[model samples]
Structure formats: C-alpha cells, structure tokens
Target: MTSIEETAPGRDHFTDFDLDSPEFTEDYEQVLGDLVAKCPVAHSKVAGGYYVVSRYDDVRQCAQDWETFSSEGGFEPGRGGEGGAKLYPVELDPPYQTRWRNALGPYFSPRAIRSREANIREQVNYLIDGFIEKGRVDFVEEFAAHLPGRVFFGSFLGVPFSELPPIQKATDDAMRGPMEGRGEAWVAVATFLDGYLRARQEEPPRDDFIDVILAGVEDHDGNPCSWDHKLYVLTDLLAGGIGTTTYLLAGIAHHLATHPEDRAALAEDRSLWSGAIEEFIRYYASIVALGRTATRPTEVAGQSIAEGDFLMLSFAAACRDPKYFENPHEIDIRRKIAVNPAFSFGPHRCIGSHIARLEATISLEEILRRLPDLALAEGGEPVYSNSTIARNMDSLVVTFTPGEREGRTE
Candidate 1:
C-alpha cells in the first residue's frame, strides 16, 4: 500500500489503503467501510501480492472454500515466506487437520472447560484482589496479559511457573514478525521444549496436558506425532490461547470504561453479560484479520484471484458490514444472535471459543460485581499494539472504589 507524508496524487485509489497503516488502528470501521463500499476485493502491495476481502459475504465465502483458500499458506513473519511457528491444525487441512483438532480441541471443549472454572474463578479473583484494595490497576500487564496464559499455558498445559517467562517472551517476540535474533529466540524456546519433553520421558505418565500429549497423541497415521510437530502444537496452543483472550478482555474493559451506559446496563442486569460479551467481542475484535492463500485460480465477490495469491479476510471489517448488521457502528448488546466472525468461520473457527466465552463471561460478571464503581483510572489512557493481523491495547488503567473480595474457597 502506498503512503505519502503530504496529500500526493492518486491517494484516493484502494491501492493506497494499507491494513498496517497506523490510521487503521484509529478508525478501521471508517477505513474498511470505504473499502467494502468501493473495493470489496481490493489489491494491496504490502507483504507481497495480496487481495483484501472486506465484505462479510466475500470473507465468509473465502473461509468456506478452504480448499481454494488454504490456511497452509503460513503467515509467519520470517522463516523465508512461511509465517512463524507452525500452528498445527490451523496450518493443516482436512483429515490431517482433523487429527490435530481431535487431539487438542477436546481439551478446550465446553464440558472440559467446566473443570477449569473453579480454578479460573480463583485465579481471576486472586489477581483482582491483588489490586482491588489499591483502587487502580494496569489491567493489561497485571491481568489480561498474565491470566489466560497462566490458565491455559501455565496451569492447563503444565508448564512450570519457573520456566514460563522466557518461553512466553520468545513466542511473543517471534510473532511480532521478523526481528533480530528471532531465530535464536525460537531456538531457545524449542530447546526448552526439548528438555521439557526429555524430562517428561523419564517420569511416569501424569494427567497433565503435557503428559497426555507426550504419552502419545497420535497423528493421522495412527503413530505418535513427532516431537517437532508436538512442539509446534504446543507453541500454537500457547500463542493462540493467550493474546487472543488478553486483547479481547482488554477491549471489553476499554469498552466498559468508554461506554458507561452499556457498562451500567451490563452491571445492572447480569443475565445480559453473555450476549453482551459476544457483542463486545464483535464490536472490538482484537484478532482483526487472518490470511489464506488461493490454492488455484479462484473467484470471490466477482473478482478473479490467481493461484498462490494471498487473500486477507478482514474479520473486524466483516463484523461491521451494514448488510448483516443494522446501525453497524453503534454497539448494541441485544443484537440478534446470528453468525459472528469474531472467532472466525468454517473448520478453522476458534477451537477455544467456548473456553474464551466462559472465561469472558465469568470475568465480566466478577469484575462488575467487585468493581461496580470502576472507571478510567484518574488520567490514565489506554495503549494499543496495532498490526494488520491483530490490534490489542497494550494497557488500560482503571479505577474503582476500594472494595472487599468475596473470599471464595478454591
């Protein structure tokens, strides 16, 4: 995409629009609305040749045709053309993908997630209690950034607390795209996983996710998936499970802070939270966009797409399509329950969607219960990390009247 410091000629063309442009973070709805209205299948020059599908129907069509729009065309920052760290099932297709899904999806299934609620509640409450008395807190670092990973990665996946920090850093750094020493950082992570597996190999089988995975989660061939494959699975699980929730929670918190009317309604009517959470997820989709490569000559939204060409599905944009959503810009908690693209679509729809919903629901209920008076913490401002793939707030400072905890037992 083209950019100019001053208003230069030909800036009105869709080619001048860029997902990575800083303006997108500020007003994507406005920008993407224009794209959908004018160029639903607009071409972008950034990150090699790509066509961005902005309309809901078009994006949905691409997602449905995974055969034509393969997810195997990776999105890693470096490693030659491939996206960083293989994402297992998300990076696989069909029967093989089904194997990866079976091995992992059950863990986050709604029934399985119920087993985690007590701990999730305890963990979330404990984190809030840490700063509840202080009346102010950095929600991102102190909570959002730490909680989901701690639950899914640290607690569920059985990574020792002592070893989580470095690996978490490595995964994050590597995802922020190609940078100096990303390979080294990735290697460090792989080395840690290797050692972790080796240590597990010596011990008796345990019930932990790691132990079960190590004991032998079979591939499509009915043989155990290789350690390398396992490493990517672990990496994908950790990476996918953490920041997505972090950003979503952060976005919700931001919404509550900025839109106090909606916040008040949610607070007053607890039953509204479940649907409201979904609405919030739609309104402020943090996993903004994902890519698929055309496997062969394909057509979408009347635009001819060549094989091997990249097509970016703008989920945030799709969620706001006026065709599907009335008063699209306005946040309505009671919007009729139809398909939402916040978790994506088709076979690759978010595996942890149920877990994420439960977590967000519980979190919403608890935070509102405890901090009924919570608001923007003094003069604090929210910060965000904007990228084409995802744009999440970096931090959100919020305040509430110092309150007592429920002191529930574990």
Candidate 2:
C-alpha cells in the first residue's frame, strides 16, 4: 500500500481553486457545479496533500464506511495535527467509538430533549423580547446566535444567563480558528466549566444534561468517567450544540430574507416550516466538509488513494450534487426528500441533530409568526464566519414591521 505521504507525481486539478476565498462562499453553487462536472475526485495540492471528494455518493460512503475512512486522526486536518490528543468519541472509530456514543446518547435523546423544550422556548422568547423593541437588529447577535448559547449554558448547566456571553464569545473564538489573544479563550471556557462542574458535583442530580452525564454510568468504558473526561465531553457538547445551531439559524434567516417567494410561502403556511428547514439544511448545509484519514490504502471512485491519506469530504458539494438532488442548486421547500447526508450518516452522525432541528424549527416558527414583515437591512449582506468545520454568518441585520411583543411562557 502506497503511503499518503508518498506524493504521487500527477497534475493537481484543484490547484487553481482557493477554498478560503470569499468568492467561494458567495458563489459556491457555481464552483461546486464546476467541480462535480469536471472532477468529482480531484487532487488538491493546496489543501496540504489531500484528495477532495465532491460527489454526493463518494462523500456519503466515506462517512458510512468508518473502517475504510477512520476519524482516529480527528475531523479537521489542521486541528487533528495540532492537539496530539484525540477528543473523545468524535476522534475514535467504532467499536470503541460506540462506547462514547452510547454514553452521551441518552442525554440527547428525543424524549430527554422534549423535557427541556419548555425551558428552551422560554429562553428563546426572552431574547426575542430583549431586541423586539428595536424593530431592526442584528439577527445573529440579537437572536439567532444568542438563543443556542444561552440555552446550552443556562438550561443545560442551570447557569445564570448573565454568564453566557463571555462563554459564548470564548467558544466562538476557539472554533473560528486561532485568533490573536484567542489562546486564552478556550482556557477561559475550560476554567469556567471546571469550576461550574465542581460546584455541581456535590449536589443531587437534576433534570439538566450536566446532572445526567455527571451521575450516569459509562456503559462501555467500564470505569466511571473521570472529571477530565467529563469536562472534555461537556466542552464538545457546548461547542457542537451552540456553534452549529447558531450557524443553521443564521443560514435559515439568510435564505428566507434573500428568497422572498420562499419566505412568503413559509409565512403563509407554518406547516411548511419542516420542509423549509430541511431545504435550508440542504441548501446551506451548516458544515462545508468533514475530515477523515485513511486507515490503510484504499481505492474510491476508480482513484487509488494511499494509506494515512487525509480526506476532505465536501458536504456542501455533496448536498448540491445533481446526481442525488434534482435542480441541486435551487432552494425548493416543496421538494420531496429521500435522504440527505446534511446531518451526516452512520455511527458518527451528529448526536445533537434532533435538538438542533427542534431549536431551528421553534425559532423560525416564532420569528415568522411574530414578525412576518422581516426584511434584511437595506443594501447589506450578513457577515459570515471564516471557518472550515462550521459555516455561519456572524451578523444578520433584519428590519421588521412594528407590532406588539408576544408574551412567552415557561
């Protein structure tokens, strides 16, 4: 088996393209269409020696067949190489990965999530009311971004809402890649969570997720999870639950604001919210791609890939693949969906996906019901975060018609 490090002497097809370019985000459809048509499995010299899989089936297969394409290295190539330590279940391959999954699964179950819906809704409406009086506000900061962070911090840990902003900012900075002065941001989150966990450790278990995980026994690992493991898991939960949900909500808002017809259709009939949300996931696909390393030499789509090769599975490209979706570029709420790997596939699929959907659905429904006349700020596009793992707009300024604020119940 040829090692991935052994560079093959071949013309790299995607050398002309730059993934970090803003044009790539703005004109992703055209770019993805071109990639799918010309080279579905193209070699990239710029991506530090990794083959890019742009087609839907190829990417799906990479995610499904965990044995062939292992995540032991980590998800993102850059991050995977950095820490030297793999973070819990996301970095572990099955049957070992199964243990981590099972341990965290019960807490995020549909029934467990439903139990927190009342509290989640309460926080959502509270944030909505805080900015509703302005009539025009940055939806991302004021609403979309704020909801998940507060809910995760406050509801999940029973923390005060006042403490959420600093934590949210720290997590956001950490995920958006290493920035100047951002090194301490992650440490800040760790420090805060450590203190919070220690304080809660002596108390009786409650309905919150922290309590569940702290008290719950490990099903596979045999020994109880150490406080360090619990902290890592909680950090993962906070980052995944808040960051991705914020991006999805922002994406939904962007799509609705830009596409008037779709917005009108959704506004008129709230029943279409489910389909619209699905379409949003397909269209924006909060994550652009997920990374994996080849456990051994493998052949995929007639291309010979070497062992220890880093693979970039293009989630954005896959969702827009014409082979699977008709009019792949079009955002159609009415499209009948079979299955899309937007939430991913197989054992490593998103654990918090159900909760993400619920949060997005509830947020969208409430926004539409209360502010039907919502419109993007004149002559402005939302500011998006430059991130590999999560696709998100930073700030979305929206103007809404004047109206009486609705009262929220817990």
Best by TM-score: 2
Per residue, candidate 1 scores C-alpha lDDT tens digits across 1-410 of 33332222334426655667666666656666667666787777776657778888888888877889888777422222444557666676676776667666767788888888887887688778777878888888777776776676565757765666677677666544355866787677667767777787898877655665675566667777777777777666666766788888877777777778887888788788878888877877777678888889978888898888887788888888889988878888878748888778887888878877877887887788887776887666887666667877777999878987656432
List, in order, the clash count of every candidate structure: 4, 0
Off by over 4 Å in 1: 1-13, 76-84, 159-189, 204-212, 215-224, 404-410
Return the number of clashes found in candidate 1. Answer: 4
Residue-by-residue lDDT tens digits, candidate 2, 1-410 = 22222322222235434455565666556667766766677665555666778888888889899988988777776655544323656776787668667767887888888877888888878877877878887888777767887878877777776666777777667655356756677788788888888888888767566775576455346777566667766777777777678878888877777778887888888788887778777887777777789988898787888888887788878888888889988888887667766777787788887788788888888777777777888855787654656577777888887666666523
Q: In candidate 1, which residue pairs clash?
A: 75-83, 76-83, 76-84, 383-394
**Runs in model 2 with CA error above 4 Å?**
1-13, 16-18, 81-86, 176-178, 215-226, 405-410
RMSD of each: 3.9, 4.9
